[model samples]
Target: MAQFYSAKRRVTTRQIITVTVNDLDPFGQGVARHNGKALFIAGALPGEQAEVTVTEDKRNFAQAVVKRRLSDSSERVAPRCRHFGVCGGCQQQHASVELQQQAKSRALARMMGTRDAPREVDEIIADNPWGYRRRARLSLNFHLKSQTLQMGFRKASDKELVNIHQCPVLAPQLEALLEPLRQCLSELKAVRRLGHVELVLADSGPLMVLRHLSPLENGDRQKLEQFSQTTGVALFLAPDSETLEAPGNVAPWYHSDGLRLSFSPRDFIQVNDAVNQQMVARAIDWLDIQPTDRVLDLFCGMGNFTLPLAKRAASVVGVEGVAALVAKGEYNARHNSLKNVTFFHENLEEDVTRHPWAALGFDKILLDPARAGAPGVMQHVINLAPQRVVYVSCNPTTLARDSEALLSAGYQIRRLAMLDMFPHTGHLESMALFERI
Candidate 1:
């Protein structure tokens, strides 16, 4: 028999080091240098000295958590939410809103200039820094130790939920329901069966969607209904992920560009209504739509932009990947009595020129692609050679990557604006204008 020697597992000790922060990155992490390697410290701002513990050790960069800040930046301000640092809902709450906007503006400029494109960020669109969030999702977990249901958002960098009693970022109406909602859930007989809760404020009022893994008892159902009736919140229950049941048969709707648009609870809508309205206005202004110009709107979600553009242009064609939104768009167009706009359901990831709608000449084009950006459609846009193009992007990195194709095709970036769609968060939304030279 051969004897093999097994070495004992070595325990790596965490290193605590003091570093001087140099700058803030786009993701709201403080950048520092240690031992010739880049160090990223969380909860630390620029122009601050912090003692940090390294959490991740990489070849070129290390990630650390701030143990304490020996010095603070003048831009630092007290966060409004008590759960600011722990909750994953926000990242820049410690920094002043002005500082956060400035950091974002600088980061946006750098991302756009990566391909040697224009470095100027033309405008920054912002609104009230607090109480602007019209939507939020709360996590639910049954704690065995305490024998209670925990309702809150997930902790930063952890799967555990933070018991949020008050969230300042939520709209005033939604935030007011936090305590009552938690109390009501605690009394439910099927509390353990609850998965999560989604709160959304439509133009009509605030609506609640309760997700449950199992069927609720009769008493529990009555309790939920009573809670809804008492609070005046439209309540819907989800027995499964895909199924939603509204006892009152309520239809949620919102207004945009003076048009009332009805949407399902799970449908996509902007969280910040004020900023969304402004964004739509700016996009139209940049496109410079004329009455005789035929416009093409890609990834047009439920005619959010298509209908608005239709009000100005001769003909507006809205293309969406989701068939449901296409139907909704058509319904909204009819609802708004705008016959000039047409909605089509098509997958934008493939060659779109084969579609009959693509064959039609469009003088101006606007696209609001998701985080993946418009990968397969950029070349087609270039091929069409529209007189003007407007791109609304949620991710700056992808926007920069996709802009290269447009720049190579003799489309000059005429304007760029940083949209503060989500305040106190690292989300960077932007709008750009490009004109054929």
Candidate 2:
């Protein structure tokens, strides 16, 4: 065992230390303590002893990389993807899914003040851990010396790209096209001009969007179109950042609660479709919507929750920051023949209490804010004084910070669940139901 000692930053000297990991943080880093400071070790797990080298030293905590894992935890498992360590897409693949969820729940419990308290995660919503990603964005790089094209995810914590031959996490329909798509892009005359590619598996069919820096040659266009026809993948080209051109009329849409929502290629749809469906259902159930209840949904995108809530409530008002999405939400309401739901475009970061929709009393409120969280809107939400509020968050840190206002306003947590939206990854998504006390 190595000695525990504090040292100043050195230019050449190296020090190795042995530490016993006591716990796993929510982001999957192993937690250890030495000399009254926490040490976060990478590639280590709870109940494991690791020989590690401190990479960065700070006052409260230190970061280290394991030189050798002296002991392994029972939760450790072989990763399915060959590029597991190299690719930055996933962090917790070495740990079992059950362990991952447990760590996440513990972290969430601590964040929500339910760890040693009465409130705890009521349920953990999860699905097939592998092959669940319905959408993916792949980076492209053209090597000058080899005269070849490399396509895949980025390297872990680095800008270099890892050439992926296969990805097990992608939906089977989209994963099957990886090799063929790579071959097709390599053969294109404008291969050097390719920027990146995005693959999405919709209920209707698979769709591909090629981001190219320069105009494609006529022959290259024909080749892409041919590839699309052969593979039955709808093809779209992005000549610039803002525009998307489809060779064929392709309107991609996915099924949610028996409603059809049409979306453009670049729209923000849930990466895990199965979890999204279950999440929507659970959100509705936890809200306990009644026929007489009028609900307000903040940060609503294309009626994912708005239209679904409309099914249970008397009226649902959807507010979105993006005008395009608000327009699409209205279109989807009309498409679904849902007359009670209305969509309004408003900047949620500002004071929205003065908005016309804000004036009307709502029995229930639901918010699905982005990673930044609803900074300026949380207090406003408290002012509305709805009977129930369900907050769906992608970032737990922000969720905890924003929950202060609601908790202070006498809103007690009625239910909480951990949404395993992205498995084998450090991203934690959760939902909390708060009822006025």
Candidate 3:
């Protein structure tokens, strides 16, 4: 189907339009208007005048990026990362951390409130702003024209590869391998057959998973092992038939709140260690589990909170949509020797009220759904009659939508806090506690 667009007038591409940024959107884009239609300009801050080029013209709105800044905002700060504008890994780096937190805090408050006046906000939970990311996915751009492999990140605006020498956001040990991996890949004849690579800094050490379309020769395998031995990066190659190429290794585990969690190489884990720790601590405290309580955890990945809740509650049942995560959750429970905790495989988005697991009454419930939010199951939450519910969210817009559903079902928000998980990015992580009226 062809796309229909709304515009004040037909505008040609690459047309330069001077506009004053009125405010910032959740994506860090500057919001403005031209001829009554909304225009989004990237890299332009509020209270600044910028000359932007129209990149995409759409119905009701258009996308653009600032070509030149004519005026500056008082909150703008120098970005710490040299590749800030190009790498696309980090956004809102030019703004002060204080302003970024304030923006996110107010956004959440506005979503939670009945009026425009800023809702009363508790202090934000924060940690070190830099070197917080523990896991990174680097791209493999095999250029046939130049016969070179660009092992780095893509540009913020497009799929064009931007070769990185170092990334300031990644942990120190992982950042040091940026150039080394590039050099190592350059010598491989199978470089073009390589897929994207995932580099992770686990509590045990650094691990690398290389997805390959073709097999690596014996010589190449030896070279990779040597690279691993020299750099101490546990390298595993997928799609290889032999276990020798990809070591059959146990899941890497991280300890938090007296519980040990083991996750697969590809399993999701919080990238910011410090903030994740605090987030877990807050969840456990807010839930106020009791020895006679049976708690239900929705979207519980790898038992991050299930095991901790198990220590206080009579029993904790963790439900995950992904079998891999459920398996890891079971493994983590065994690794931690928590007999009161159990994991079940079920899609949280589907109706599961009849599932035998749901037959058990839950005194309190905790939800840590993905960015899409857990709207499908929210309408049925009242059936369980949980006394309290703690919601952990990554997206504010979705959280607001779900909160309304819970409110209509007789739940009142008791406590809320904004977690500064990604300090320099235009991302928001919030935790709220709601009680049945």
Please provide, for model 2 over 268-382, each residue's C-alpha lDDT reduced to its tens digit, 9 standing for 90 to 100: 9999999999999999998999999999999998889999999889999999999999988998999999999999999999989889998999899999999999988888889
Candidate 2, run of 10 with poorest lDDT: 5-14
Candidate 1: where is the Cα deviation over 4 Å? 1-9, 115-118
**Tens-place lDDT digits, model 3, residues 305-382:** 888898899999999998988988888788778899889999888889878888888999999999999997786667
Lowest lDDT sum, 10 consecutive residues, model 1, at 3-12
Supply the global lDDT for candidate 2.
0.92
Candidate 1 Cα deviation (angstroms), residue 102: 1.2
lDDT of predicted model 1: 0.92
Per-prediction count of colliding residue pairs?
Answer: 0, 0, 1
lDDT of 1 by residue, 318-354 (tens): 9999998998889989988999998899999988989
Better of 1 and 2 by TM-score: 2
Global Cα lDDT for candidate 3: 0.84
Stretches off by above 4 angstroms in model 3 are 1-20, 33-38, 51-64, 114-120, 240-245, 248-250
